[model samples]
Target: NIINARLRGKPGLFRVALNGERIAAIVPQTDVVAPAKGNDLDAGQNLVVAPFVEPHIHLDATLTAGEPKWNMSGTLFEGIERWSERKEITTHDDIKTRAKKTIGMLVDHGIQHVRTHVDVTDPKLTALKAMVEVRDEVRELIDLQIVAFPQEGIESYANGRALMTEAVAIGADVVGGIPHFENTRDQGVSSVKFLMDLAERTGCLVDVHCDETDDPQSRFLEVLAEEARVRGMGARVTASHTVAMGSYDNAY
Candidate 1:
């Protein structure tokens, strides 16, 4: 238990009890001091909060500002273009080294959990393999969730389906797709269905990069949502970077 804890944005001293790592109870402070116990902590009016959670991050591409070439345009496609070149020259050790350093910074800032999307578009699966190793290596320091993300496209890229299958067979905790990046709208819908079906077959979570483009016409989010709702798997699915939602018309 932590006594004399100051509640954030609240006027009061409180006592926080724990059931293992989770908070079991919290009550207003009564006594000036808590009884001496080896396990108990005295917060001394300091604010306490649970460690931060990083829901979306790309550990594979972290700490690479201008390695191969600069993304002078600062657009998503440009970033992907730079990363494609970077991935070509990046070795396994280089990926692991960069990912570990990035995780170290997250840990120092009180982030205890992280979900990193490792690109699996490459037929070689260089990033996914390297991140899988780093996930196990940093398990003691933080909880790492590795998603097999197809950065380029599922149907647009060559041998995309096979690479995704191999990624999950290896150690990917989640299945990912970039629907907006597909060349055609039909292919985007098919990619969403394919990724959802793959997750079900492999018993993995889904975290798709859906509707990342600024085009309001990109309505793949509906397909993804309907797929999850129809299958009763909404809790196991996530749609990240839905930037098009903001540009969408109010009437629709």
Candidate 2:
């Protein structure tokens, strides 16, 4: 009864050995045990290796489809607007159900860790509360980190900042901001500063959706980078969707 077996040495010319069972020895080429009389066991050259990490992803919006309507504009802003409409109808049960299903999908795909951003712009904090429950429920299968994401602008939407703080109070693992979505440039920059302060106060990681636009003038990423550097929270800060970086001019 061979418990485990692995090939060692050069490809197509390696020694196969079995261990952790009755037979636990490395045999020479000639001494190698052949398959049963008629059974065939092909020794393939290539080997499969396990993954190291799952990196980042959004679990809250994973499986949501056609709630109020579809995003016909195909732009990120339109997606946000569409999501806002859908979010208005979001309930604790709705979020919990989708989150559990999304987590199951991640586990099946071999993802062991995930950093999910749950929108907290709603006053009810439905998604944030549901994610906390899902995180604890699936702790054994997948490691989950929840971000208190202000999908709507922190200052553009009424009571947005308060909702973000409430999410952190309810056990969100990170603080997130959408600076580019702010109504004005100054407000956009200010939102970044405010989110950083919130993270510091709540002792959470900072992840922002900065400069996710195609416009070349979008520069909130620099603001975020500078804020992260000044606060000594560079390592704990992550700037997502910095698409504007592609169009940044070197002269400035």
Candidate 3:
């Protein structure tokens, strides 16, 4: 038997055996092997689980609240607009410092995996570069995945595709979009298609900020699902912030 070690909860009621980094078996506490073998660790009856994962976070925009002012409107649009002003003064060092500190907090909370969306709409790619540096620097402590996100819009923003391409070339791990922020419904649908095509071309995963509004007519998620199904990229695609789903009718 190639058993690596055993993990137990306080008093050893539940036990799990590992092979290398993978779980080999989960046995009862009564069946646990003696710890004298030097591989058994009792976790003191607390909840013993795999490290936590944070799926969606904005590393570039985090810890920048109330820089020039506050988001009095309390809407996503207002937040984005306010962030634009703050972003004007942002530097690579600023992004790296904030991101590293936030990652430290996440690690303290037992989060070993995190996927962060870094804004790529900026022509300078300041945040993307800094995040890539942070990603490599913290690789030993966390699995950090970066998304090349066009927070403004895919088509609505100037040179958005070019910026996104530069972002991935510099080490962004995934493709991202903000379809709900497009100028119109037609533009929103087109943006999703563009992102799906981009993902296929680059062989990157997709995560979109879809319909993060309370409007019942926000249907970008439906388009996103259909595109994912048509392209056979089902599980690899994710639609985040679909708050509008709450307003959907039961029949829908």
The C-alpha lDDT values of all candidates are: 0.92, 0.79, 0.86
Q: What digit string (tens of lDDT, one per residue) describes model 1 on residues 1-252?
A: 888898888788898898997899998876557647797799888888888999999999998989788999999899999999888888889999999999999998999999999999887898898998898899899999999999999999999999899999999999999999999999999999999999999899999999998998999999999999999999999999999999899997
Candidate 2's displacement at residue 233, Å, is: 1.1
lDDT of 2 at 73: 82
Top-down TM-score ranking: 1, 3, 2
Please list the residue runs of candidate 3 whose C-alpha ends up more than 4 Å from where it truly belongs after superposition: 1-18, 24-46
Kindly provide the TM-score of model 3 when superposed on the true structure, using C-alpha atoms.
0.86
Scanning candidate 3 in windows of ten residues, the lowest lDDT window is: 1-10
lDDT tens per residue, model 2, 126-173:
888888999999998877899888888799989988888888889998
Candidate 3 lDDT tens digits, 143-230: 9999999988888999987888788889888999888888888989888988898888889999998889888889999999999999
- Give me the candidate number with maximum lDDT: 1
Using Cα atoms with residue i matched to residue i, what is each candidate's TM-score against the true structure? 0.88, 0.81, 0.86
Clashes per prediction?
0, 0, 1
In model 3, residue pairs whose N, Cα or C atoms come closer than 3 Å (at least 3 residues apart or on different chains), thus clashing, are: 10-45
Cand. 2 TM to true fold: 0.81
**Sort order, lDDT high to low:** 1, 3, 2
